[model samples]
Target: MPPAPDDRPGPSRNLAVDFCGVSRSYGRVRAVAGLDLRIAEGEVVALLGPNGAGKSTTLDMVLGLTDPDTGTARVLGTTPADAVRHGRVGAVLQTGELLPHVTVGELVELVAALHDRPLGVDDALRTAGIGDLRSRRTTALSGGQVQRVRFAVALVGDPVLLVLDEPTASLDVASRAALWETIRGQAQAGRTILFATHHLEEADTYADRIVLLARGQVVADGPVTELTGATRGRTLRATVPGADLDRLSALPGVRTAEARGEAVVLHCTDSDRALRALLSTGPSARDIEVTGADLTDAFLALTADPPR
Candidate 1:
């Protein structure tokens, strides 16, 4: 028999999720390779990686859908399955079939009933921005609306930790913003949020920390600004009519140059020197903008395959 929740030996009470030397495999494929990660309570962490980087496998272990082949994965000071059974962890997965012939409210209510201590079904619907769609049948929902229903189901459990895999997969721009706002509120209320997304901008704007994975291993982990700052140099953009791409690429401090319509973009180690050179050499340059490397730039740099 498994130990009781309080009796389980945990590393810390403040950690919401803990994976120590955790690994999982499928036949010959190593899905997760000795991962060690810890997320504290009230943290909003974004898990980022290219496809086949073991992101889904890592999340699966956290949700107790699969066990690690070696080592341990704990949630809320207990086993993942134990935490989930006690309504302490909730998840919104990328795919799950909703029950047919049920209204949105009915579906949420049904999920709430499964938890030992769940939030009100109406509250969950409102938080997910689907209160107005409560009377609508699950079969009638659009892709984005269906995503919100999944969110409502997760929220209804009132879990201490929330795991979202592609949470905004089918959302429109406005719906995406709205859902993030709700997630922000959840974080402010002290719930730990761990999400995986391909949208770098979402991770940049929302996550307190980012864990980037590649080849079934963590390639980078840090705050958005810290990781992005590690990527050398700035990016310069300007309208330079009839620009010579090769000339810009050859300029001192400019690492690379590309043309976008009438504009020229320069990846620069020294934006001040590059901008001055651009204006002096190409007098047609205008509308200049210099910005530091963003999350996308950092992601590309960190996850890129090594050249042969």
Candidate 2:
């Protein structure tokens, strides 16, 4: 008797996904240029970048849907195609076209049948939070429901590594949050996951590490806290009558300052110093408040090009 699918070899202890000197080009445009990224087993990593940043191309290479023009893309100590063929890899790409007539349950079960060893259909459904929608026709489901079903399909293979491309792109706030919880749960279960998204909050909140891409190259890579801290600080807001916004902007530890009605908003590197300066130099300074930087601020500042 053959080993069950669940008994197949799991992801190796080494890299789950590795790109070495990989490059791809289309006509006159370069999609990925001399890229190198290594994702270890059982890690949750986010590939973050704006449009035209080669994120999709990188995922494509990892999925074996496209070949790198110059170098190697490896998964699980083997080619991506080999890993996928052995049921070690699973993915939810940006676009999915579910059959209209099949119920969600049937669709997922069908996908499970294609793999050597797969999770029980019901288990996949429950994991994806779509068990209640099992009987619903695929065509009748809402966008979020469709995504959930697709996630179930991805899990049916019981893959060791999962890839999701902008899984929450079309979801509303509530759906996005719900799906994020599911993804986090998967990561916590020791499954390696790689997702690509432009949402700063998603990367910051859910991933163990963030790999920031720019113009087809890795611009930053590190733990979420360190990467965000590199570009983030406290913000100071105060109601200062007849505020000298220019002077405030030039204050020590203040990155930028602007006036909004009677309030001056300051993006600060050192909030304590900024506040001290405000009180000592400006007679009208009052109603001062300081806030820690959120992901949005860090993302923008990190992605911004530095002065020449």
How many backbone overlaps does candidate 1 show? 0
Q: Model 2 Cα RMSD, Å?
A: 5.9
Residue 65 alpha-carbon offset, candidate 2, angstroms: 0.9
Model 2: ten consecutive residues of lowest lDDT: 1-10
The 10-residue segment of model 1 with minimum total lDDT is 1-10
Candidate 1 yields a Cα-based lDDT of 0.88
Residue 297 error, candidate 1, Å: 1.0
* Tens-digit per-residue lDDT, 58-82, candidate 1: 9989999999999899888899999
